[model samples]
Target chain A: MRPGRRIAGWVFIAPALIVIGVFFLLPVLLAVGLSLTDFDIYALASLRNLQFVGLDNYLAVLRMGLFWRALGNTLYFVVVGVPLSIGAALGAALLVHSRLARCRGFFRVALFTPVVTNLIAVAVIWKYLFQTRYGIVNFVLGRFGVHPVDWLGDPHMAMPTIILFALWKNFGYAMIIVLAGLQAIPDELYEAARLDGASAWRQLRHITLPLLGPTLMTVGLLTMVGYFQLFAEPYVMTEGGPLQSTLSVLYLMYNQGFDWWNLGLASAIAFVLFVFTLAATGLLVRAGRRKGWV
Target chain B: MNRARAAAWTVNGLLAVLALVTLFPLLWMLSVSLMPQGSASTFPPPLLPAHPTLANYRTLFVAADLGRYLLNSLIVSGGITLGALVCNLLAGYAFAKLRFAGRDRVFGLLLAALVIPSQVAMMPLFLLVRELHIVDSYAGVILPALASIFGIYLVRQYARAIPDEMLEAARIDGAGELRIFLRVVLPLLKPIILTLTILTFLTAWNDFMWPLIVLTGNHHFTLPIALASLAREHNPDVEMLMAGSVVTVVPVLLLFLLLQRYYIQGLLLGSVKR
Candidate 1:
């Protein structure tokens, strides 16, 4: 690696670096700058409206009623959806990794199928499936003599329905990762546990779960990062409707940026979301390291 | 032995049933797509269509605007796949084996940046694209993804496996840097390129949020967008929606089926952090 060859290396990689810098890195930095000032469509007409407001946009977004509502909805989604996602993934992994699971290839493919499907298409199908009047979900409820409830049209039900969709769409990803983890565990440990008169559940708690900590941690972090970016579900199935109950932070940023053309406020919201993800990821890494898991 | 065998059998039985549960909605989607109008919602939830028909497909092609959406998806996905492959491969090779200034620091920065969500860039990026006057164009959607950090990272990881002596010998033969890259490196990197190709294609093909915001006109909508629009337009037409779903999923599904070995291998390689 000579000094002149060093120049060649940079030249070879320069195009990608430049593009990402312009589109990705520069935008991130610009977003921070935009958040500090008052920029909007009005500002676009003449640069006069763009004044340095110095945290004014963040203060404004924080004080706005809709912003709080969106944050609450996003938190509700992450709190509920994250656990459901992990739980389903764990369950599916257990079933598939079990000794009795014959034709394992077929089962793995079947479980992973939903993950690769288009979210928009599936969310569309799910919306109709849960429709209040003629939906098969309500129809099945009718058979059980339970009253029909509007799943997407009701604000309370809308977020829950979206969470369910998220869980279904995503759980398989973690399932595969965990299954791979399970497969990596040595069989001798389980055999020894069995010989020691440990029950199936006990063996699982002591051996299987402890070994799976790293995989689950990875799954958890990825799921949290993904859940924080909840937009497409609300956009498709609920449209952040029924009193804006399903409006995630990303969704809020979008509506503000594109719909209202309030770039400053939207950029603030984007920065806030990024900070939240950073904090959450940091906490996850710390916890993993503390537990000697990472 | 007998007791353990029975338990394993029971476990296998449960898994088979669970697998069926997982696949039911997709299979039902297909069945409903083929069912005659007003035929999918009967009691007992028709396991199979009484009489399968291609009317829904015909309706999608002729009545709905899905064909245009499909074309839009093709252009967007194809452009990103081809463009990103070139950028990522060149950068990856440079990062892996070539001598570069600030190489380690730059690669490390890219790795660290992976933790940051891309949505953070969206607000300003939209404004940037709008300024460029490429807003709502295929280029606007395609350009951002043309150089993916993850793709470069994946290729770098694979490229490291190429023995250094091979490159050294090429250098000893007085081959130029790009010549060594084209002749010696790329041929060894074929399998990974194919894997990355499928991965990038699927990712670009399935993108929803960005396109949803950028492409405002129906003429520029992708298949997912069109399906979503049609679902909103004709909510009562379950069969029609199913037909749209079939259109949206079948090509990627076929591609996956054909190249599953590589797909799974790519997944393992891309996901597992070293």
Candidate 2:
């Protein structure tokens, strides 16, 4: 390339590159450094109080029972939420993509509305809807002779409630993606199958599922990565609470870093969360690759 | 033919039920927002307000300072959208069309870095913002979000389809790179631009954690942050909170309704094309 062209190239990219480098890349490196130091409120007051503690924060986090609880809660959310979310998305997508479906456009838009709404706002709305005494959900259940269940107030129920809220909020996104994948499958394959006395269920099992493997893997990875960052739901709905049953690792990090000014500990938690997300997604990618689906 | 009709009815019936379930909360939010204060707190949680009133909305705007928060949201979301568009478009076009040393390597590095969650950088980024003395300000919220890797990726994916010969023709006509970009490339990138605008605006408007941390003062709080803080207060007002949610959500919902075609197209292009 000519020098002028090369110079122009750099000029075009320089602004964005500089911003990303300074704000994002620099902070990530600094976070790793920050995690190693005892940078609490005292450090916030003066750099003189900061101590170079070197993995002590990570060790402390490992030994903390609350951290373990937070991890377990996050894992439970991911384990249950990811599959259910993907299933909902797939179900919605298949319904919308069905040849017999009517008002596909309206159903698609209605389902997707939650994805675009503010999570904090919706979580607050959900918190009210699941109120123990006056909630419509329990009121409806009462008609079936079932007693009112404490949805958000009960420890065992809070996490499940949050997961349900997340599924409602997010399924539309993957639904849209999966719908696109579904559309790409040729109708001729199904037509041929029908001619051979194949049922819709059999066609789906044999052809649709296999063809959608790559798309499913992609959706799974994206959904899992997103599910791992479970902060806003619990933050708004439960406040990590009713015995801290819904506290996520990210929520824990927020409390430590901002609320308590345990910046070092928070940074360590952040790194641990990042590592878990990376490892989990990495394993998914490898599995997809081995199956030749990615 | 009867069997086919039955299948159609079954599928459509199921879709209707799912749609209703999906949209109920938002519909409920709008419903309860119009209810008389404290009426929604009763048993069975009235589906529609007894007397649909704007009392809650009036209270929110007049007493709760929601209008101020709305303005803050507009400023922050608008600023980030405009700035991010310019930056991402320029860089994304350059990566796809322009040749420079280490260009591929740099782009590869960015793609690899995508897996690192943004929260990991929040602590130090907060410190950095404090150091710059922009803490508790709109600049702190807008600056960090000015460019995103995903935005760049989206633009590059769309811009790659711009024919190379067109750019070369413009270059051969004595047009500068900047002029060619402004005159030639940008018009072609309109669809993706719309997609990015809607995506960025929605993300910025709905964003909670970062702005909540950065904008420490109530005066600078965005709609989401303001609503969250209000909801967290003791003896919360249900109708008023729902009203606040309606105010926070309606603009983006309207935007999505209007331009959903572009938004969905962009979603597919960004995720599936790769």
Candidate 3:
């Protein structure tokens, strides 16, 4: 309560408060205002051209087919990608956490390498690996008598390919978290189960799953939130191409806001994405609570 | 016992295969970068180069001008790391140690704001930068990074563990708050500061969307932005693109390899506490 301490507190926190206030928080508030106006390149040239359109931008974005298509693409990504990643993470965690497993350190690093690698760079590598004719993915598939599927070049396949790439890159991160959760489970539970003649599968199904509920919920929510903002992968890999199947909501916002400079429409798309994110997160939390995991 | 041994073999075998699958793309990237020009586009898709060379790397630097982008990335990321460290440390320490009104309320606001994805503010943030005439400049890319809610939270969590009595001892010895922070608290927070530095650097270096939006010309491009633009121009040149990937990924990959403990700890500390 001393004046000196209070003043020091204010001084220490001022720089961060100012920067975040002016850049992050202020922009968020301004975005809502910007969304309600017809702000475009013309407005950029002259502020007098900026017109207050109220909720028209939001209505226009709602009616726009591209916006809906982008939303669908994003939803398709989250719906499929979240489960694929969690499954892979759970499997990898179980494997690495297995008593029979060896070289735990090596395996962990190798798996996690992808998560830390440059997105645009790895995306480029993936583009090559899935490059139809000369691509290694198709080349390997041919050995199995499976024909070369156009991974990124086909509309239906593009989103799936992106999903595959995402799962591969991201699962390790979740796996590491799950592995931590796995380790936290006391050894006596397994020992007790073993003495009772319960199988490893039974132990995992009953004990591991029940205990890992909270961790899995958190992982699932984080993965869903992250996947909803898919941008860089498709930006570098497909450019939302092959009939725009890989175009995400964030990608749409990027194109509208940056590429086209339609700040109003772009802000509306951003908010729409925000709403979906909130709704999905809320649903997950509710589901978690209903299951008594939270 | 035989069945148990067999199960162990199966688990290890699957793990080996999984590790291989995970690392195959990155390994192939290194190999293709060494392959002779146009060799990676072969029928079997050669795993390694017949006559290994640095020609692709040479072309990346000399012909593609990746060196400039690399320097730009270093400057921008370094600037951000240093600036963010100072700001976050001061604020985080203040939130943890100093007495102030509305401190908890403001911190709670920041925690809530974390749910608002950064992309939601990108449109107006970009416009704001333009109004400030920072667009197409490195300042635009580096300035926003000076304020990070997550960074502040991370530092605060670590700072709270610095026993208050140590700070009190320093204060009683006629050391001012700023002096105590620099002379007394900083030494205790070295590990965390390093972790923050690495995280901020990696995030800034690998950052794509913001840089791509802000940096218009090739002159100001970071590695990721430069590589993305280069991919568009040289999509068919598989070997060349791999070389670009290597150039873009190698620095961060090396950094992670060197500081794996700090990086992973930062990740776990940030996530598990949630």
Candidate 4:
């Protein structure tokens, strides 16, 4: 590249860089700063009430039982949701990858269709499907002598319902990624395993999982991170639920930020979520390194 | 011919059942949408409607103001696609081919920024929008989305594959950078641009979270927001909600079905490790 051309390159990129830096980076810094303060609706009208309380907002979030409830709900989503989603994805991929599978392309598309469908649209469908009285789900359950359950209205079932919808919508993504991983695995490994009299289960445990380590880590971490940002499902399906059972931290943050206009407190909540996500991501990476997975 | 073969078929057959279960809700949503107003709530739960009608769609267009929401979605999604393409293309080109001070460092910083959830910035961003007095306006919903980090990353990877010798030759011919970019680089990069265009539009169109929070009014509400609100208010109107679901979901479904290859390829590209 010529010297004059280099200047043009910088010029081409400068506007976007400036826009991102000012609008995105600056606000994030301000949010971190604001999280340390007690900026509320009062502070919104006037800056006089905006006094820096030095971790007071964070402490308040810690003390709030709602935050704990939201955290527990989010963790429940992560721990259970991630595994089930990954398992479903893996199961689907295995089927698609199998030699016995015919019309593989059609099944792949059918399974993946849900991944790209509008979340709000499908969550609405799930909400209605899980409706307590006259719902298809309960109606089906009644055939087996099980009574109708208030899925979204019951504290026990609300989060689980959200998790199920999430799995249905999301697992296809992991399936595609894992299918790619499965394809990348050398056929020779499986052939060698078969020659050694290895069963399918043993081959999967020793050869498939071991060889799929890096992709598995990436899949796990990505799934965990994605699941933690749980908002639209609960917001649409349960509205954070009958007992706030489906309320993830991000949903609570949005309710606080937009509904109550507690910008400072919401920013604190967002930072706490960021901290939790970062810690989880960091732990995954550490574990990956320790196990030589990456 | 053998028990093992039958067992394998059984496993696949069970998976086929599971696949149908997964897709049943979406198909049922459409089925209900086509049903008459109260036909959706029945005891036997008809697989296909007894008497299908376009009345629900007519209702969506006339009574529910979904026509306006559809227009808004198209405009917002179109504007985002146009703006994101230019910004991502230029910046991605710069990242891939350009030389400037702190180029690697700036790129590294951007990569690091990707890890921080956008929600961390959401609170401060809302405040900034409020201060600008642009909250609830179209600009609030569109501006921040115009330049996505992921879009840039996608374009950078695509642009990096362009032959550097061609750009050098164009520069030697006394063509300006912008002209060369427009005439030379862009034509060569057409396929990826199309892919990114579809992706950015679909993402912005189907986006729920930020738009839901920022655009609160009925007028400003996008398709997803309008559908979500309708779901809340008219829960009993299963036909109406299903109609709304079809309205929100059908366009993207068509787009995906038509361009499944690009969409799927782009999906794998943006996410999975090569």
Predictions in order: chain A TM-score? 0.95, 0.98, 0.98, 0.95
Off by over 4 Å in 2: none
Candidate 2 overall Cα lDDT vs. reference?
Answer: 0.93
Tell how far residue B34 is off in model 4, in angstroms: 1.5
Where in model 1 is the C-alpha error above 4 Å? A1-4, B1-6, B38-47, B234-236
Task: Give stretches of model 4 more than 4 Å off.
Answer: A1-3, B234-236, B272-274
How well is each residue in A197-286 modelled by candidate 4, as lDDT tens digits?
999899999988887787778888889999999999988887888788989999999989888888889999998988998898898889
* Full ranking by lDDT: 2, 3, 4, 1
lDDT of 1 by residue, B50-129 (tens): 89999999888888767888898899999999999999999999999986558999999988878767877887888789
Clashes of 1: 1
Q: Which stretches of candidate 3 lie over 4 Å from their true place?
A: none
For residues A1-294, write the lDDT of model 1, one tens digit per residue.
Answer: 445565778887988898899999999888889898888889978778899999998888888899888888988998899979998899889988887777788888888888888888788778867878767778788899988889999888999989988887888888888888999999999999989999999998999998999888888888888898999898888778888888888999998888888888888998888888778778888999997778
Arranged by DockQ with the best first, the candidates are: 2, 3, 4, 1
RMSD of candidate 3 to the truth, in angstroms, is: 1.2
After TM-score superposition, the amount by which residue A253's alpha carbon in candidate 4 deviates from its true location, in angstroms, is: 0.8
Clashing pairs in 3: none
Model 1 per-residue lDDT at B234: 40
DockQ of 1: 0.62
Using TM-score as the measure, name the better of candidate 2 and candidate 4. 2
lDDT of 3 by residue, B86-202 (tens): 999999999998878889999999888888999878888988998999999999999999979998999899999988899888888888889999998889889888889889899
Model 1 chain B poorest ten-residue lDDT run: B38-47
- What CA RMSD would you report for each candidate? 2.2, 1.2, 1.2, 1.7
- lDDT at position A265, candidate 3: 89
